[model samples]
Target chain A: MGRWEPNATDRLVVAALELFETNGYENTTVIGIAERAGLTKSTFFRHFQDKREVLFGRSSLADVLAEGIAKAPADAEPLEAVACALELLAQDVFTPERRDFIARRQAVVATHPELREREALKGLGLIAAMTGALERRGLPALTARVTAELGALALELAYTRWGSASRDFTEVAREALDEVRSAAPAR
Target chain B: MGRWEPNATDRLVVAALELFETNGYENTTVIGIAERAGLTKSTFFRHFQDKREVLFGRSSLADVLAEGIAKAPADAEPLEAVACALELLAQDVFTPERRDFIARRQAVVATHPELREREALKGLGLIAAMTGALERRGLPALTARVTAELGALALELAYTRWGSASRDFTEVAREALDEVRSAAPAR
Candidate 1:
């Protein structure tokens, strides 16, 4: 029903992840990934700029998540707004096929110091953007920043738990959020 | 009238920071830093295991801050307890010399990806410890985690601003907390 041009990008990503897991991230080249995927070097470069981008290519998710948060209903509380934003992000940005891929990507990144630093920077950038959105909603700067950070922490915990082989992402995220709420001081 | 032997650890840290700023973090070795501080390789190793530790030797402050939060008066609200804990930490953990040293260390870490990840992991560990403290106070798990994350966020923002050339740490922290309160939705 839909016109798809062989989904070259997905093919590239899958090949890259496989090569990274088997041969180590540093040892896998763009040419090797392309060859494994049955594509040419030009096709690989057409989809990704370099080897690092093969694993870290979804940085665009940050912008999409930030926009979702910024556009959340104004009537919602800061925490609720952030949660809704994340839920929407989970549905839109994290598909089941991509989920396993992401888990492997995270594992690879976690093992490499340089990749971990890049991941940290990416997380910081998302939190900063969310903070800005909250500030625009008449929240004070520090409050906005705290709310954003809290949201990020919750997301991180949920992602880590969900990425485990035994769990599903949605259920894990819901449980994680509930855990966060239950831990709060009574009003 | 003072009967204090010079702190060999502090001297090493200072020398390391100076060398890192002058010669770049990767270029400055442990032996060079120790020599500049009039200490030997053994003395440097006694104080710090590696060059990286010189920039990351502040985990003790996290322990003190967590302990202070755990021991806050029973009647204080979670956020209030956290603020009080931070105040105590500022007095006991962050001396004037340490403040300047930390600021320099932050600049160096910010520029290097590996150092940044180490900082993130350190921050995550501190937040987890604080969350456990809040849970022990009967706060729900989620709430405790959120509150701890918020506290860390506030501290990070305050510290970054204070660590700048123009501001004091305590003053910036107080201001940041006030901003957080003001940003909260009307109850």
Candidate 2:
């Protein structure tokens, strides 16, 4: 057996996701999450403000995705760059073991109307960041916005598909991008 | 001058939006919103669950949008149907006065990370419903999802642009759709 011990933050997220999936989002409290994680309420508070934060604390992934977007080849077209960035993000962020957890997290967020609204805002922020990057590459405002929106939409669709199954996210994302390309009008 | 009396729900929404814009979301209280609307806290409770619901009580707008999707023309392609449905929704559901309220509500939601997430979830739910409607018209699951997502993104972009200025939403939405179409490879 591995001697690695899970950190308090990791344990809290796992426990919270489980409680959120098993019991219910509204019913799951910070105390319950902390106890389930085998930690004190103070420890949980140290990691997150409340139950809602536990599900959303994974926001670091957004920064990683942004970094991937920044690293796309300079010669790539706007759409191609976005697709490549999403592919990289899928490979790095949504590991196989995280698929089920993501699905459950989505389900929990879906069940709560407030949480759903928050999710949309987060998506819009990410798109805005991507738009800035595209603009820096000399794309026009409208074109950049559209490209970022398309990329975000494709990533969302691919994530949903991957979350619904056991497929690797990188593969699913690439396939989704291919599907989009094939469906587009021929050049 | 014409005598005008706003309904309780309308008054509440307007009051809440104003307060959210000026005082900020977390700082605005239910009692203050009720008082500004010329209603009691009890009356506010009769219409909504709590302070947060004052800004978010229009969940029925999703149903209205969904109905538009369901009522789209039978011969229309998936993207065309989605664009038309969103256009119809803008005309039928979101009026000029209501657009102001929506702008303020969006601003407040944007300022709060949690509220942003909740808004994302709501958009996702709307897109899912739109996807189901497209699927009923013979679109495959992935295609339906992508079309619906693209449509939703287009609508959001148009709404943001329209809400920022004095432009008509229906006109802006149609123009935004044209922009999306123009960006696509020639058919």
Best by lDDT: 2
Cα lDDT tens digits for candidate 1, A1-187: 2233387788888898888789888888888998888888888777777777776675475676677677888897888777776777777876566677678888888877767756776777778788887888887676677667767777788877767646555566666656665554443
The models' CA-based lDDT, in order, is 0.74, 0.76
Q: What's the C-alpha lDDT at position B92 in model 2?
A: 74
Q: Model 1 chain A: which ten-residue window has the lowest total lDDT?
A: A178-187
> Model 2's CAPRI class?
acceptable
Clashes of each: 14, 16
Over 4 Å off in model 1, which ranges?
A1-9, A15-54, A70-84, A96-121, A133-140, A157-187, B1-6, B24-27, B40-46, B96-117, B161-175, B185-187
Instruction: Quote the positional error of residue B147 for candidate 2 in Å.
Output: 2.5
| Tens digits of per-residue lDDT for model 2, A1-187 | 3233459788888898888779888888888998998887888877787677787776565676667777889888888877777877776778887777788788888988657655776777778888888888887887777677677777777878888977778888777767765554322
Error of 1 at A142 (Å): 2.6
Residues B1-187, candidate 1: write the lDDT tens digits.
3233278887888898898889988899999998999888888777677888877774576777678787899987887778876787677765566677678888888877767767887787778778888888887766677777777767777778767746556667767766655544332
Error of 2 at B150 (Å): 2.6
Candidate 1 at residue A21, lDDT?
Answer: 87
